[model samples]
Target: MIRIGIVYMATGYYCRFWKEFYISCETFFCIDAEKGYEVFTDSIELLKMNIPNVSFHAIKDKGWIINVSSKSDFICSISERLRQNYDYIYYLNGNFRCLKSIYSTEILPEEQNGYFAALSFQHNRYKSPNEYHYDRNKNSHAYIPFGKGKRYYQASFYGGRTDELLKFSEWSRNMINKDISNGIIARYQDESYLNCYLQDSEPLVLSDAYGYSDFTHYQGEYKAELINKNQYLGTSLLHARSLLPVSQVKLQGNLGDQMFGFAFYCYLKKFWRDGQRKTILSLLPEGRRTTDSLYGVFPIDITDDIKIVEQQCKNLPEKKIIKVTEKFSSVFYQVEDFNAPVVVFDGKWQCYQYAEACEDELRESFQFSLTHLSEQSKEILNKIRSCKCSVSVHVPANTADSYNILLQKIISDNYFERAMEQMRISLQCEPIFFFFRDECPVEELWEELFLISQCKHHIITNNSFSWWGAWLGKNTEKLVIAPKNWSFWKDTPDLLPTEWIKLPINIDKKQLNNIIGQQILKSQVTENIGLYNGKMGYVLFFFHCARFLNNIWYEEYAEELLSEIYEGIHWDLSISFSSGLCGIGWGIEYLVHHGFVAGCTDDILSELDKKVMEIDIRRIEDKSLEHGLKGITCYVSSRISSPRDIVSTLPFDPSYLNELKEACLRLNIKMTQLTSINDILKGIKTYYMKLHKGAPLWCELYCVIDKIEKM
Candidate 1:
């Protein structure tokens, strides 16, 4: 008979999320009658009451240090204590919910002395091998080994044979003790030590299927299967303690000892009350609008109109407003319960309503000014002001040709001429056409709006910016001309005011030149504003003490040497050590075989240097060549075998490397193929001196040279 035990701990606030985990686990175990399951926790009485059939073991507080470090120690101790009774022991974190029954057969191997662990989904933070550092002086609980690339296992769900687990626990405990004695802690408490231990141990690695955290949002094959079949699976962290804000969790008025319930209640009450009283206007910007495809409209900046809307709201006595600035979808999940009446101000509101709302105070607030203007800009402004009327034209470049044709029809309908004629008759000023084009400075554009506002008459486009500018203009007798159709798909009746003249969409193009008399010259005031594929070099430093030694002095020396070589030259430098586990060997082999200068061969280095010089000289003659030139160099330190073996060392499938090779060949890019420690004092000194001088010292030059010569 197989004996399996699931152990967890719940001390303080851990109980809140633990409830779900506990219930889920109990439900799963109850369905499987053949499996003998036992749960061990500090809250045994509570568990026994909640889950009647399951056996509960109460862990008495033995006055052990209660920190992240102590938590691991406690887990190890429990595993050790239960080793004799259970053949297979599984330790699950209190926050981990078992949605389905994970049979021992499914997870554990049939044979004994087998260890199992799952890779962490939170690979960016804890699993980054490059970022692993443990200093004795620092009071932290996380450690990452030097020069190791990110490959980590989550300690939340790890189990093995009773004897193997006990031994693993003991070894981890010893490491912790050593760290504690030296007044230091591992980077991630138990998780760090577990990773350190596993680096030297062979464990059965499980995919993210077994240990799915909240961060793993993508429903992979396993997760999809669980969902499709309506089966329950494991979920690691339902609620992350670090992410939850303290104020959000703090209890206000508690009905009982339940803090989470009380806090949630208080949160809902406060936000709901505030939401109920306010007239919530959700202004979805063009980027935020989800119905853009349905409407067949181009994106427009509604920032100015938003201000107008806010000003209009302020004028109304009963408009108790709460403006939600972001997209509705993003914030809806957070405050879904706060049921407020939402009004999306999509630029189809009545113009007179806005015009009447724009009081003296509103107009003053909407007025724009430029603190400084260039001479060319000043001259352009003068020319625009000299015109009897200013026109704002909207061309639908991003939309279909049909939309542009409609715009062209409006432009050719003698609209600008008629508007100018009207302005000349009324305001007795000559109208000058002004429109914003690409590369127009923002300040100058705002100034154009200000200039348009000053105009006695305006020819407006089917744009929110133009509408707002015309509305905000100081002219009392302004002739606001707008297109009949705001969009081809929809008729915008409320877009134009009764006072503003609406031009027909299909106006005659021949009648256009008659009213204007002369051709309106297009604005001549123009504003103009405006690592791969090259000779590469690789420096390989083969130092025997590269992996084992944590001496800061060597690191500092390496960094200095790298900086010196990298400062003046446009070389893309990478400093790596002779570490097999870090995949440096694989990187070097790929580089060397692909015709990249390894710096080991004098002939190759000289040729590369000559190419670099030639490129520099060519760049002086043709600036266009310099545009394509980029840094393409690297510093490699590892012993590499043949290209085939190097490619095999990658964690991924061998086919991926083949695809990579194919891609490199297609792109005409070279891959360089570039090891292990010897504690020779003379070799070490020589390597250090060579590194300090920024000189490449190849220990195994023949290996790469021989491979390259054959190629």
Candidate 2:
């Protein structure tokens, strides 16, 4: 029998994948070979439960613990033993699974000029030379100049005769050590090291199918598959402890497109234990100047993240760009695969959970303050508040060029007629309707949208602007009716909330009634006990949700839940981007500086000011973004790392920010209400350096900004 040794490092979060890999290997791998499994893991107790043909190395030695702290370190430690013991040695990733019976002939190195040698599988994502993700940082040992690498080899699957593989392992350890001593990690970590070695030594470059990944859209059969295990384990703790990936995401498309992309980016951050604050590369079309579009619309500070690498996006020399797009309104890339270190996001990524994952941030970014509403708008809001039920119904005027008019016609008059009948029955009461006229004045945009957001419910012609209103609305149990199959080209994705009732264009009133759900059938009549703003707004929120979602049945048990909010002022309450606040007048600084309209009345701001003024922010003790004064201020401070626009800073004067800063003196926070391009660059570089220290490697990318003024 041909003796074979397969090493698997199943330490940390990867521990769960061990048995699956072992079983698949035993069942499908070369049956003729005498296979010996060498397991390197920290989970000895969990892995030792009735397994066979495997020797578990505890991985407890101080030498192993303090070394490279990567899979390569564990494999290198056993290279010598395996070399002396087995005829051939292979190091397989824990996530890799064997699918078909494979003889040693398929994987084992063949005689190359009378000597058995090493072999590696080509990376599935990068194929051509330019697309190869070779380290380009000229400062590192693994650095391969722009166009030198022959083939990009994935480090996940590779093996050879023990003597040859041991030599390869030692070479990798030396290169990694050198890179570490110089404080520069090769791009993609050990993968770059492997690619660097494979470039010169012409190993048998197998096809990409040998090491296929689940995310790869290719439908071809493969030997081993790379699958996700997050569904089976607690990823938060494991991912947090593992080596930080040198991954960077580059978003592509327009402002609206990026809004969805950024949300997905935020989702990736949460999934990988990396917050969305890290500067991501924003790749736009050539000649498009990167604009500070987040401005007041997003809950982001310019100084916080250094995203966008392309200096004007002119020199298009980026090695690899794995573009992700939607196919028939379906997600092109799995949400889980998005967490990988390097990927390009393009087109519309309307994954429902993408928004839900970062819903708090999204809400906070779009917050609109009471004072920010104009006098006319405030009146409209008051009316919305007074109504027992307010439902926004968006409709565009006849315009030949616009898509909305076309879609509106597609839904036709019958859709609205049915919607009206459905609304009446669902609410079980008369409900007011709001519209979105195509010719509405630009100046009235904020007021119009603010009025829409205040509404208890929404019905719409396909419109992104109005869709945002429903997204930012306050009612947890509110009704949102959208025309199903609104587009002509493809089946529309669930861009709206799943609970939001969807009616086919020609559906009968009876069909609509059936789809509206039982919860909506019951809760149309609100008591209107209090206005939906300020502290009292919270009570109404629970009351609203309690009627439909019985999760909070003990709603009446609270003792003075309103005590914490700024004295009994009416505030619009909704889910917000961050935890701090979502009421009309809440998170004032964040709302004003980020995106929410700050057009509030003096009474509202004055009352909120009193709450912060009364407390010594540091002494508040609650180190949370919601309750503590210090926490609230810190949350606001953390957002404005380096913003480049001042228009959103309007109405909420500099004096207001000063008062906030004065309230939290010496609290290690920066609330600079104004930011310059220089400030933006400096902040971005500072952020990059921090990542360089901890994560070390960065993909070569460029952020294109065409609209911003160059300093």
Q: lDDT of each prediction vs. the true structure?
A: 0.41, 0.54
Steric collisions counted per model: 29, 35
Instruction: Give the Cα-based TM-score of candidate 2 against the true structure.
Output: 0.37
Worst 10-residue lDDT window, candidate 2: 695-704
lDDT per residue as tens, model 2, 253-300:
434445666676666655644221122435344523333233334444
Task: State every prediction's TM-score relative to the real structure.
Answer: 0.28, 0.37
Minimal lDDT window, size 10, model 1: 526-535
lDDT of 1 by residue, 1-711 (tens): 676666565543454445676567666632332333354445644555655435555654311122334554565655645765677666676556656665556667434324554444544444446554432223332444466434566767777766766676677777776665543435455777777666555566655666666455645633211121111222212122111111111211111111112223233334433212121222332424332111112222335334434543333333222233323211111444321122222212223443343354344434343545567767766776676555544232333333333345435636556655555565555555565432354334455445555655567665555665677666677777776654443334545677887764444424322211121121111110000110111122211112123334433443343333333232332211221111222233334554332433223233333333333222222111112211111112122233344334423234534553454455454444322221211233344445553111122221222222233
Model 1 stretches with alpha carbons more than 4 Å out: 29-68, 76-81, 110-113, 122-128, 131-144, 221-711
* Global fold similarity of model 1 (TM-score): 0.28
